[model samples]
Target: MKEVLVGSACAIALALLAGCSAEQPAGPAPATRPLDPTAADLVARAGSYYADEQVLQDAEATLVHRCMTTRGFRRPPPAPAAPVSHDEEWRPDPAHRRTDGYGLARAGRGEPPDPYFVALAPAHQERYQRELVGDMARRATLDLPSGPQLSYPTTGCLAESRAQLYGDVMEATRVTSVTQDLHNTVYLAAQADPEYRRTLARWADCMKRRGHPYGSPQQARNALAAERRSAAPTAAQRHEVAVAVADAECAAEVALPGTFESLLRRHAELLPEAQRAELNRLATSRAAALRHARQVAQR
Candidate 1:
């Protein structure tokens, strides 16, 4: 699959895992930390600016199909309709862990091949690739603050799809990307906070009690990765599910999500006013884009 313009909430879960761990062993902190109103408002504001990644994926698929078929190519199979959630601000929860189990099974179920593309002649395949994503030699780039530079094509079905939804593909890409960078920034700041560390230690202890000996969620995930390599496929899957379930349970026991949210709020206040304004402007554009995307998706 071609990479999307923005990241999903789950994409940030890796950083969340690291932020939720501790260096020093300690008991869980008090579970009653008062929520910060300012931070809550900031998150609420940020969430308003974005849709779930699945929604964008499905919509773009619709647009891409239209663009391709107009150029006389065979229409690809329609993308399945995604369950839409406009203001989804993802936080780690045990239910997701129980169901996805670190997403190994989902990862294993690789993307299906496109029959139309597969049957194409080599020359036609080259045309298809160019039509889908444009020239690889010439690309547009965006240099994000405190993040790596991002580049993509300025033409083709991919570009057309993005333009249809975001109005200005390059600018929208830069604008929407800020939320992810902000999330990364907050997570890094949270890692150094003593309160967050203490809560993580409690979570570690909780996991240890449940028969998973791990100092951090990242460590447990690493161990699972190695286990997948060494153990039988079935056995590895079973082990992964067991450890993931225990990890979620321990996270709950230690009030990990609540603590992390508190830390997010505390650290989020440090963001510059200019960045916040950018987010607000992006939200306006996103809302307008989603309206168009919804209509296209329905067709």
Candidate 2:
């Protein structure tokens, strides 16, 4: 009986050990994979990693920009008019307007500004800067979402987003200014021969008044692109446009700078050798591109 009891206890112990071995024991929980980060985070990461990767990005951007520009990309024109400065009008300084507007224009010392010109005037820019800063302060103070009377934010959102938006708008304004200036200057350049300027301006102004609206070099160009995109022209229109384009190209081909060597020699004093070489290369490349585009357009 003693031997049998001992054997039974041993058997039970072996069974228990076997059960322990076969049964799985729990360990620490598996870690959760992190979630995908937000746009801001991704941008931040890109900025960090590619902070110095300007060469490739810059080169690509430049090429694309040149292509777009040659293809007649244009920003909108200058605001026809900007809002008057109510605050300035209220203060009622008689001389300020004369100085800010007429005086600077005549003196040629600084920019004579309405709302537009003051920003560029080195001398008076500070004054307008102060005014602008004050305006921004008021905007910021009134930036809350609760107002019933407020319109679209001239400066909207908060923090960086607001800053980015404001910057984009401001840049648009500056471009408009410069573009309009370019338009004006091109007119002035034409005015060097007054009879021609008068003739062209009269025709262009008539076109503008009739609501055609493509009044400047870039505008006419962009309009041509837009028109081409919308429809295939009628046979008569195509023939007329083709004839006009061919005439212009014939004139332009004759007007190409005398030669590459002449260009370098003439601009030798003002332009560096590398710059001249690059400019020549660019001009040659651009001419080739223009010829290619013209050929495609004709077909």
Candidate 3:
């Protein structure tokens, strides 16, 4: 089983602050231009990469298991979880909205412990780690054209798998970062839009009427997190569920999801030609990688 690295509560709080924002602004015009062919292809390719990587990971796990067994060790192959569908990431589902507050908390839940890892002896565990990550545990830093340097492990099955899928790790990282930045820009734009702000205000008012006064979804999430730290952790669960349901209700009442999606679609059109070309390149690369993955898995 993978060790659940529990950072200090302070660190976790800081991380939550850095990673999530409660408020999402109103979206773009409904008739905004559709995604161009290149962009559409890129999106499809990016989506497919998840499945491709699973294939590669499975193959890599098998290789590792075989290698370990040959050395007189009992190591079971990895069991990858089913792929999650993110089609509704932006879409609001009224039926299940109440089940997970904004769905963010639910999405962030950690994976269950791996049975294979749990069965290993302490010495074998150390040996397995060494073999998977490499004895030297090498690291490398790639200086990106923008942002902070990308530091990555230069050893391990994880590293090897990535290398096999994306030939040049640094280039792949750069491309991924660029795509992410594009999405972030769109999100920021939506947040600043007057229409989005108005809808958010309406949502806030709705929540207030429900006896859960919150300025934004982020505030509610933060409050729930703080409550969990209290002596009665489970006590907050009911409140969390209530708030989440209300959040979704408010979002639906205001047509916030539709607006957000419209804005995202509009912003996607603003992607630069160079970025589109890079996405195309990435798509081609991933296709090849997927083929390679299938062959490796078969062997």
Candidate 4:
């Protein structure tokens, strides 16, 4: 468990697939069938351990602002709330498909530059970074479950803010990575299971009937992702909506969401004892951090 000391001094912060060529009509929203009581209970239990990222980011920015202002730097504007996550499901949720589709174009457009920071001289900017984040030469690192290592400043205002909110900053970070790992593990497992493969085949058949010819939802999303970069933004978004509508309809036709949830529940039950203990401990830490974050954000 390496403590991640690396963070942005300014404040450490924090996908659709597929292209349809023509803009198809987005009719009534597809129905996402309600999960059974057992599945719903599991989802609720798992969800409780996680804090809202946007709220947490808001809290962090607030803490960083207060810390920097006390130290005499002009305050940076509040960072925008984190965008909705695409990986919330294997496919886009109903609202996401209807609204943003893949929403790739919208990325990198919303973050406002820090005017106060921008006005500083080059020498001053370097000093600001050091003061805001801590020593750039020294780093703290955490290895993600997905094989990538994340590094950040551990000694700056960002670190102090994180420590204030989360008792053990590294453990707090680990909670997120661990849960992400769990989701990836379970999702891949779901894809491997016979029942899920059958559902996917049915979904593929549905997509074929609709003229998408995609083998999996991910494949469609991938194709769209590639196409979006070349096409006009408006055209790409419209195509996304059209494809997303078809994707949702096909997913409903096979009850893919429910099937995935069922597999997730089953996989969670089978996790190793050590991993489960880790989750329980991390969840407790996250719950406490979330409480403090809410208080900070409110102030």
Q: Is candidate 2 or candidate 4 better by TM-score?
A: 4
Candidate 3 runs further than 4 Å off: 1-74, 82-127, 135-138, 143-146, 168-178, 271-273, 290-299
lDDT of 3: 0.63
Best by lDDT: 4
True-structure RMSD, every candidate: 18.1, 28.5, 19.0, 20.3
Q: Give the alpha-carbon lDDT of every model.
A: 0.70, 0.33, 0.63, 0.70
Q: What are the per-residue Cα lDDT tens digits for candidate 2 across 1-299?
A: 55554556547768776532345789988653221222111112222222222222333233333433343433232232222232111022233332232111223346344554333557555543433333354442222111222222233222222223223433322222322332333333433444443433544555455444433333444455455446564533453244233322322333312222122222232333333343344333323333433343343
lDDT tens digits, residues 120-168, model 1? 8999889999999987887788766676888878888888789889887
Candidate 2 vs 3: which has more lDDT: 3
Ranking by lDDT: 4, 1, 3, 2
- State the local distance difference test value for candidate 4: 0.70
lDDT of 4 by residue, 202-244 (tens): 9999989988898987788789888888998788888888888
After TM-score superposition, the amount by which residue 288's alpha carbon in candidate 4 deviates from its true location, in angstroms, is 0.7
Candidate 4: C-alpha RMSD after superposition: 20.3
**TM-score for each candidate, following the candidate numbering:** 0.75, 0.21, 0.63, 0.74
Candidate 4 residue runs with Cα over 4 Å from true position: 1-51, 76-83, 86-91, 107-116, 143-149, 229-233
